[model samples]
Structures are given as structure tokens and as C-alpha cells.
Target: MKDQSNSNNDPIYYQEATTLAKLIRNKEISSVEVVQAHLDRIAEINPRINGVVTLMGEQALKSAALADKAVSSGEELGPLHGVPFSIKDAIDTAGVPTKRGSKIFEDFIPEKDATVVTRMKNAGAIPLMKTNIPEFSAHWESDNLVTGRSLNPWNPDRTPGGSSGGESAVIAAGLSPIGLGSDVAISLRGPAAFTGISALKATHGRVPYTGHFPQALSRFWHIGPMARTVRDVALGYSIINGADGIDGYGIFAKDAAPATFRIPGQKIRVGWVSDTAFGPVDPEITTAIKATAKLLADVGCDVAEVRLPFMENTDWLTPYFNLVYGELVPYMQQYTRGRESELHFIGKATMDYPLLNAAEYVKAEATIEKLRMHFAGYFQEYDVLLCPVNPMTATGHGLNEYIVDGKTVSAYHVMTATAPFNMTGLPALSVPVRLSSETLPINIQLVSRWFDEATILALGEKIQTGSEAYGKHPIN
Candidate 1:
């Protein structure tokens, strides 16, 4: 509806959230100008990617006006003051229809904000719209009966990675600077890698998970920040990290202010792996990860190869699916009580699956603790673990198979490198390094000890300093 182009043709639409906030705070640009520029970009490009299914232009402009007034009133603003952000459809936004890319909840609107959303608003970030996701967010691609599908901005024929795919798509397409997304089994990390963006799957309970729907698998599910830069993730994490008194899983740090937000000065220990128990990683992806590790090592980091026995010879699906059906099936039944036919395909499949017994669930929980302890010992020798976020890059839409180094693997195999951290409830970050041979985005995963998101962020920042992945947009 408006022309948002700059005179020199530099794409202001793709500027990072922190840059936009600084401009607004310094009066170099108005909040309305920044929000309107992004709204214009979304209107222009979202049709191709289908990243943003809902439009909140009017509401965003109103909020931007209020932010400008606050700046004019000489009030001290939060870190993200006057920045525009999007919310994954799975996360609740007060008065917004959080349809979750499904038909059953197509008409549903939340009366209150999610804890993460509340904190973002408190930090002066305005919600521009709701991004798309899979039906009930159960798949690796963001498509459903409601918003249809979200395509990768890098290549429309491919997916942007699922659940949080739409958020990553919009950010890569310059429609939004940053966004909020949830990860249960590689949802955020996978999409972030696929779309060439930076995302953090914060340690469990680091960010409160209150006010989200389908509270099944709450133990491992996490809501976190997806941005163009790793520093933005650290800033958003600080604002949203804390107990809200509603989420039973939320925790308070022992320190007055967590040091994870601060940059460390000493040389850090790092470990890397191209593949886990999952064999046959793409050669190009391995090269990208090795390049990233070498960059960190060049900057005075003690980088080496590290292996954990807990990650070998084991199928991640066994425990992950067991926990999913054991915990999520009941919640699915509660929602689809009498309307089985109304359920999405994945939801119906989940409901039809044979749930694990109480003993099996107990065993599954015990196995999770075992893997956690093994990784804990592994981290004792290294401050962070670097690995491939996915065995390959983004894949074609509506497809279920992938060719990873001449081996045909199912879609679930893409989660092999990521779901382990989800099972352990450890902090993991996905940082883009370079483009694959196919010209698709390739990213490296960074894992830290439980509740130690700071180390990963610090290390990601170091690599980012010498990398070309940051702010490289798909649509100029």
C-alpha cells in the first residue's frame, strides 16, 4: 500500500531488529516508518512464500505511533524498542487468531498473550502478524488446510523447514526483522538452518511456555527467539527468560543477572562433529560445518572433535515418538473428542498411534536422563559442541524423501542432529555458515550445557564476526 524503498536502493526492509531499534531510539528513523516498511515488504513478497498468513498492519502502525510518543516523552526504553516482530501461529497473541495452521482452531482467538509475547511487548517490540505452521505443528513443513503452505524464500520449490518454517521464511524474505517460535523436535533449529537465519532453542524452562495450546510434551517443548543475528537472540532471551508464576516448568537463575548475556574474554573450548550416530551426512554440509569450526579456532578457540556414546547406534524416533504419543495423545483426544473426522492428517495419525504404556514412558524418561548425563560429562571437557543442524539443507515441498550423500532417507532423518538436544532439554543454537553446493542455506548447530545459552551465543558471535551468513537476504 506504500512505497518503502530507499533512494540508494539499499534494502532497508532486511535490516536487523537491533539496527531498527537503534534508529528509532536515536530519532534517526520513526517507528512508524520502520513498521510500515516491513508491512510493505510483507505485502509484496509473502504471497510467494506464504510466510505471513495473518496481517496486522493497522494494529502495528498504532503501536508504532505509541512507541514514537514514548521516545518523544524522554522515557527510557527497553533493548528492542520500536522493533517489529512476528509470532509463530502456535504462540498465542492477545486478540489474534492463533489458528496454528489448522482448520479445527480456525476461528479461535486468544484473549491473553503468551508469556514470551508479553515480555516482547514490554521490551517495545510490536507484533506485525502471525506466521504459518503445520497443522497443530506436527510436521517438518509448514502446510495445512488453513494457510496452505509456506515455501522457502531461497527457493520456492523447497520448504523453509517446519513448524517455525514460516517465521524463518518471512525473516529471510525481509518481511520481518525477528520473530518468536517454538521447538519440540527441531522445529525452530531445522527451519532456521533451512532459511539462512539465526535461532536459539533455549534450554528447557529458560523461557516460560505459558498460554500456548496443546500443552502436551511441555517437558521438552521450548519457545525461543529467531533473528538475523545471534546477538538479537541473546537480547530477546534476556527479556523473556524468567518464571511467570503460571508455567510449572519455568525457573529462576541463581544469579541476580544471568551472565549469559555478557561476552566472555577467555579462550573457549569447542567440540565439533559432522555426523552423529546418524550416518551419511551431506558432504557439502560437512564442509560448511568444518569451515565454521575452523573460523572459531582461528579466533583463539580450542576446537576439537568430540563424540558421545549416547548419540550412537540409537534411533531417536523410538524415545521421541514414545514420549510424543504418551504425553500428546491425551491432549489430542481432548480437543478432537467427538469430531475425529475434523482432525488434521497428522493429528489423526497421532490419535490413532498406539500410545506407550506407563512403564515404557518411565523407561523413556530414564533414557532421557541417561543421555543428559552423558552429554553433561561431554560438555565438562568442552564449553560447547558444534555439529550440523541437519544432515542436509532444505528439501522440496510436499516431498517426504531426501538424498543425503547418496543415501535415501525419510523426512524424519533430518531431525537426527537436532532432536537429541530437544530430548535432553539442553540449549542449542542454529547459526548459518554458508550456502550449500545446491545453493541452499547450510547451518551449524551449537550446543551448551543445560541453562548455559550464553556460551553458545558467545561462540556464535565469534563465528559470525568472520562469516558471510548474517543479513544475506533471499529477496532483495
Candidate 2:
């Protein structure tokens, strides 16, 4: 990460979305300037990274100009007014081609914005572009037949973890201040960690899922915001979270404002674990998690090293994969029936996933319930759970397996630290804490109870304040 604060040397594209909005509102800068700066950054850096698959420069500039006019007229402004944000291709955008990184839907343009997209625009945030993703967002790396692979901004030789890889790369490279992305397993948090940014996967149903592609596996799917700082992520999450009436799962979602730290004299109880039943973790990652726990404890929070019994004994991955692919494979087959030859390697692999039988499906459902109960019981004692975002740092391009702590493991092992929360539908935040020996980012995940995003977010802000990785962008 390098400093880009010299206005004459570099554009303000690296500033946080919250700061940009304030500058636009106070008349220190025009919305057009902020939007154009980001568009220019995308043009300059995207050629190497291939992160932005669809650029909305023309429309974004037009919208920015209109936003400036509204500001000049003394109109009331939203929190993110005129700030440019990127959207994952998996999420729909009106008048934009949301191909979901597949050739089958390559010509499809959404007629309406997804509920989360609409909420962002309603709050005056301009859509800058549609970032890349795996076909139907089924893989960890963000490569597809439609947009190819999204390389890491820190090192082009490595991957920006997917399926939100494109969004992560663009933001980490200072192409956009903030963005919207979805997660079923590691889509949001993994990419955020790989790219050295902040992302929050709010509790399931906290944000409506209407207008996203694939339209299956709604249970594990979550949509949230990604940015360079925790504050900007909080701002984006606040605006986009809430039910839209169209998503059945979101109907009963509770509305809670973002919480402030200190909690009125109560010490936040934090439980942390570097090693768990998930799988083998890299020693560097383990050290980072332990350091973060120490940081929280030093700051007056009641922190301790802890582990859950269910996580140690239960095989969550088998049930997660069986349940997800059981529904996802069939839903995706409809589009690839005759167009199978057009799919990328990841897409082809997704279609090859085994379908679950009746008994297995029932057992998977039972396991999911048990996981939820386990987390519920754990949360009764701790307010936040801190852990590693991934077992290793960003991997080389096209890697299907990785060596973690000298042990070879499948690439899906990256999801071990993340997908459990997706299954439990708990709110989770990924905050970049340090850079590895190779200068790659290492992040820690902060998870809170269901519908209790405020706790994790408030705690994330504390961790981010001392984070060396926050507010820093890749030079390339």
C-alpha cells in the first residue's frame, strides 16, 4: 500500500466513499469530478487486471452531472450521494448486460435493478460498472468464458479471489470507492481478503435477493457491500440492508441502525480461534488472528481463545456442497443444456457436481439446523467471533489446489473459514489487518449473531482503526 493523498500527483479515486460523499455535499468537489476520477482510474488500471467487465462511464458521468446539479440547487442528499460504486456481474443492473459470466446469458440485459442495486441508487450512489465473476457465480476464482480471469491488483500473477474477484480487484486498485457484491460461500469475504479491502456479508435476508441471477440456493446466498475501509462498508450496508417485500426470506427482517462502540459501559465479549475443525490453516494466518485477538483485548474488550464443539465434530462442508449443488446444478443446467461447450472450466466443473439423493438432502437440511443451533448457543456467551478469512493468501492463477502449512488441500478449503456463517445466516465482516511476507493482504473475519450486524460492524471499526492494511491500495 502507498499514499496517494497528494492531490496534484494523484486523483482522489483512492479516498473512501464516505469521504467522497462529504466532499460532494460540502461543495469542495463536484460529483462529476469524483465519478470521472474513478472512471479514469478504471481505464488506466483495468487493462492489466481485467476486473471491470462492463463499464458504465458514459451513463455514470451523465448521472454525476445531474447529481452536481441537484447539489447546486441545495437539494437534500443521501449518505452516498454521487459516490461511484461497482456491482458484481451476478447482481442485476437495469439496462446493463448482467451475463453472470456465462455465454448462455451473454446477450441478456436486465430490465430492472436488483433490490440492493435499487437501494444504492435511491441513496444517490452511481453505478460505475459491472465487475467479473465465475459462471453463475459457482466458483471461488472469478474466471469465466464471458470476461476471462480477474487478476489480483497486488500481483497480476495471483488471483483476486472470487466469485467477487472482479469487484475486489477494481476497488483494491482504486478503480472504485465502493461496490456491491454477493456471497454464497467465499464470494465476498475471500475476495475482500485477497484484494486487501473491507466487506460485510450481512445476515441472510437482511438484504433482499431479488433480481440476482441463478435465482437458486437463496438460503445460503447473501448480498453486501465492499470498500477500502470499514466505515464506507458500514455506510453502504446501512443504505442497502432491509426487506423489499419481493423476497420472502426478507419479509420478517428486523431493522436495526448501526451501533456505536462502547455499548454504554459494557465490555464487548470477543471469542477468537486461529485453528478450528474447518481444516488446516497457514501459520502466518494463525499468527495474524492471534495478534488481532491481542489487539482487541488490549483495547479493553473481554477477549479469549475459544472453540466450538460442533465445529470440531461436524462435517459442514459435505452438507453445504451437497445442498448447494443439489439445487444449483439443476438450476444452472437449464441455461447450459445446449451451450455446454461455451462454458469455462469452472462452469463445466459446476455442472459436474454430484446431485444429492433424498436421504442425503434430508440429512443436509438437518445438519444446517444443527449448525444454526450451535452458533446460537455459542453467541449466548460471546458477542463476536474472530478468525482467519482464508487458510492462505492469494494463490497463483488457475490453481485448483493449494499447500497450506505444508499440507496439500483442495482450493475449496478457502471456504472453510467463511461458509459456516453462510450456512448459519450470521452477519460477518472481513477486515484487512496486515500484509504477508510477500506483501499480500491478510484479513480476519468478525462474525456476530443473526440480524446483529451492528455488533460486528462496531467491533470491525475498532480493529480497522489500528490496521496497517486499511486505506492502503496496491501500487499497480
Candidate 3:
């Protein structure tokens, strides 16, 4: 597809949120014009990708009219004034149905917006629609009985990774400029990589988790931004990063500052890892990650190969799953007390696991702390860690195993590379690096210390600006 992003006369569908905001604020484009452009884009593309499950066309245009009035009335405008963004169906949107990709909550509509959604609106972003997600966001692809499957714009046969799959897909397909998504595992980063976009999983509590489903796992879960560029992700992060006083996890980290992008003048210490102890990566993905490292090195960053202790096992998988089931299963059981049969199959299976006792839970928590400290020490020497977002690129839908180097492994293996950072509650940013021979996009993840999202974002922006693959649009 020819790139529409650089077409100045075109309607605002493919423009970056940051760019759209500037045009709207300066009266180059009315907010109504911008919203209509996206609505028309959705009309054309949503049938194929199914990325936007529930559109707010009437509501969005109404809001856009008021936004234009404000702009013409000489009222102060926020940074994202008049830009339209989508929310993952898993997050609440006041008066909008948040089905969360399950029949159980198909009719459920929230009376209040999620903290992140409200922040976006407060910063002058308009809600365009509720994007699709997996059942309770527990799967690898964004498919559910409620909203069906969200297809990858790059290749319909492949999945846009979940639970932020729809968010990533819509942004990549040019239906929306920016989006809100949450991640406990690889939801945010995986989908961004799969769709060839950018996303950030800020430190655990940096973005409040209020008004999201299955709120029991707040420690590891995070809500953040998915966009077409690293700077836009940073823009969204700056607006949403803060304590909302409702989520205790968010309240504890009141001092954490938002990260921004700046080209580095001096050499930045970067630690690079291509393969973890868990298994081998797709050779092409490894090559792409190393190429990214060399790109950073070419820009004067000091890059070196590094390994972590117990990385062969990567304590994140087993113990993290244990804690997840231990805390979440009971909560899910109680939440679906009367509607168990309507729950998604994955949700039902999650409740079937025998719950871990208090001691086991503590042991799992301790293991996570140990992993955190190990990374804390590692960050003492390195500014950021560059790694692959997934061992392999986006694959065909509904498969339960991945063939890596001719060996079959559980499909969940993709989470091995990303879940570790979630376990450590660190900030990790994923940006597209290169496309494989199959023409699918691959990304390298940059991870920083507990609250140092700035360093990682800066490095990610450097890689993004220097790579030719940056901002390459997928076929719609």
C-alpha cells in the first residue's frame, strides 16, 4: 500500500496523534473533520480487520464539534486536543460497553471511565471506539465470542497479538492514531511488535489500573499507550502517568516522573541479549535484534552482550503463573459467580486450577523480588537492555505450539521474553526494527530500571529514528 501518512492533503486517518493535535490546535483542520476522517476510515477497514469492535461515531463527532468550538472560542487546549484514540475493550469507557471479549459481560457498561481513559479525555483526546480483546485478555490473540477475531492488517492469516491486539491493529491500520492498552504479560509489547507499531509498559504503578477488569492482579498489570511512533507513546505516557489515589499500587509510586525522548550526546551503556535460557529464537528475529543493537552502536551507544543468573529458567514463567492463578482464579470465580457457563473457555480453565496456598504465594512473591533485585543490579551497570519482544514473529491464528528450529513448544513460549520484565515491574518499550523474509514485522524491546522509563524511551526513539523500517504502514 502506498503510504498515506505523509499526504498532507489527506484526511487525518494515518497522521500521528501528535501531528493531528498540532493541526487541530492551529486550526489547520477542524476536530470534526479529523473525527470524520477516522470514522470513514473505520467504515472502510473495520470489516476486514475487526479491530474496532464498538465504535462511538455519533458520540465522537459530537465531542469533536465541541472541541472545535473550544478551539475557535480561544479556550486553552490540551496537548492532544481533538485527537481520536481507542480503548481496549478490557478497559472501562463511561457509557460505552466494555465486553472484554466474553459473553459474560457482553451487556456490561461502565458508569465511569478507566483512569487512563479519563486522563486521555482530560488531555483533549476523543474516544473513537472500544477495541477488541481476548476473553478477559487471557489469550495470545484478540479473538472472542463477543467481538470475533481481530485480523492483522499486515497479513489477515496471522493474528494481531493480544490482549492489546485490537488496539495495536487499529492504530496500525490507520483507523486510530493512538490507543490505550494494558499488559500483565506481553499484551502491549507483543501486539505492537506484531502490528509494527510502538508501545510502552511503564513501571508497574506508573499508570493507574482503576476501572479495568480482573483488578486483583494490579501489581503486575499496567495500563499504557500504543501508537505509531516512540515520541507519541511518550506523549501518551506523560499524560497518563500518575497516582489516581484509588489503586493502591498507583498510590505508592507518587514520585515517579514520566519519560521523554532526547537524542543522546554521549555513549549510552546498552546490554544486548538475543536468546534466553528458555529456548532458541527464530534466527531472523535474532539477526534483526542484533542489527538494532548495531544501529544503536553506530549512534555512539556502548552496546555489549550480557546474561542474567537463572535466565536459563527465567523465574518469571512458572512462579508468575502460580501467583497469577492463585490470586486471579478465585477472583474470576467470584466475579462470575452466577454466570460461570458464559465465561470464555480460557476463563473457565483459569478457575479450574487448584489455587496456591498463602505460603506458596509468598514463595512466588519472593522469587519475583529476587528477580527484581538481580535486574536492579544489572541496571546499575547498563542504562537499558535491548532484546527481542518475542522469540518469533506473528504466526497463524489458533495454534497452540510454535515450531522454533524444528522443535515444537507451547505457544506461550513467546511470553518468556516479555513476562520477565512484568515480573520485575520494570518499564519496557517495544519498537519495530525490521521485517522478515515473510514480510512480517519484528521488534526489539528496550528495558530500563524500575522507574527509569526516560532512558529506555530515549534509546527507543534513537533506534526508531535511525531505522528505515520505522513508520512503515501495513497493507490495509
Query: In terms of lDDT, which candidate is strongest?
Result: 2
Give the per-residue lDDT digits (tens) of candidate 2, residues 1-476. 46444132455887788888998999999999998888778778899899988999999999999999999999999999999999999998988999889888889998999998999999999999999998889888888877788999899999998989999999989899899999999999999999889999998888888988778989789999999888889999888888788988876444754333335678988999866755588888898888899999988889999987688756688898999999999988777898888888888888999888899899999988898898888887888899888889999988778999889988888899899999988889999888899999999999987777887888788888787765556873
For residue 95, model 3's alpha carbon misses the true position, in angstroms, by 1.2
Best by TM-score: 2
lDDT of model 2, residue 117: 92
* Reference-based lDDT, each prediction: 0.83, 0.87, 0.86
lDDT of 3 by residue, 1-476 (tens): 54443335445687889999999999989999999999999999989899987999999999999999999999999999999999999999888999988898899999999989999999999999999998888877888878888999989999999989999999988899999999999999999999889999999888999999878888889899999889899999999988888989887454665432324474678988876643578888888788888988898889898876668755468888898878887777766788877766667766787777889889988988888788777877887888889888898998889897677888888898889888888899999877778888888899987788888888888888777666578863
- Which one wins by lDDT: 2 or 3? 2
Global Cα lDDT for candidate 3: 0.86
The collision pairs in model 2 are none
Off by over 4 Å in 1: 1-9, 254-266
lDDT of 2 at 281: 87
User: All candidates: CA RMSD in angstroms?
Assistant: 3.3, 2.4, 2.6
> Over all chains combined, what TM-score does candidate 2 have?
0.96
Regions more than 4 Å wrong, model 2: 1-10, 253-265
How well is each residue in 1-476 modelled by candidate 1, as lDDT tens digits?
12222122446676777778888999989999999999889888988999987889999999999999999999999888889999999999889899977778989999999999999999999999899998888888888878888999889999998889999999878898889999998898999999988899988887889977668888889999998778777787888888888889887652323223224675678888876655569998888888888898888888887766667777766777788778787877767788777766766776787887789889887877787788877866777888888888899877678888999988788899888898888899999877776678888899987777877898887776567565456776
True lDDT of residue 245, candidate 2: 88
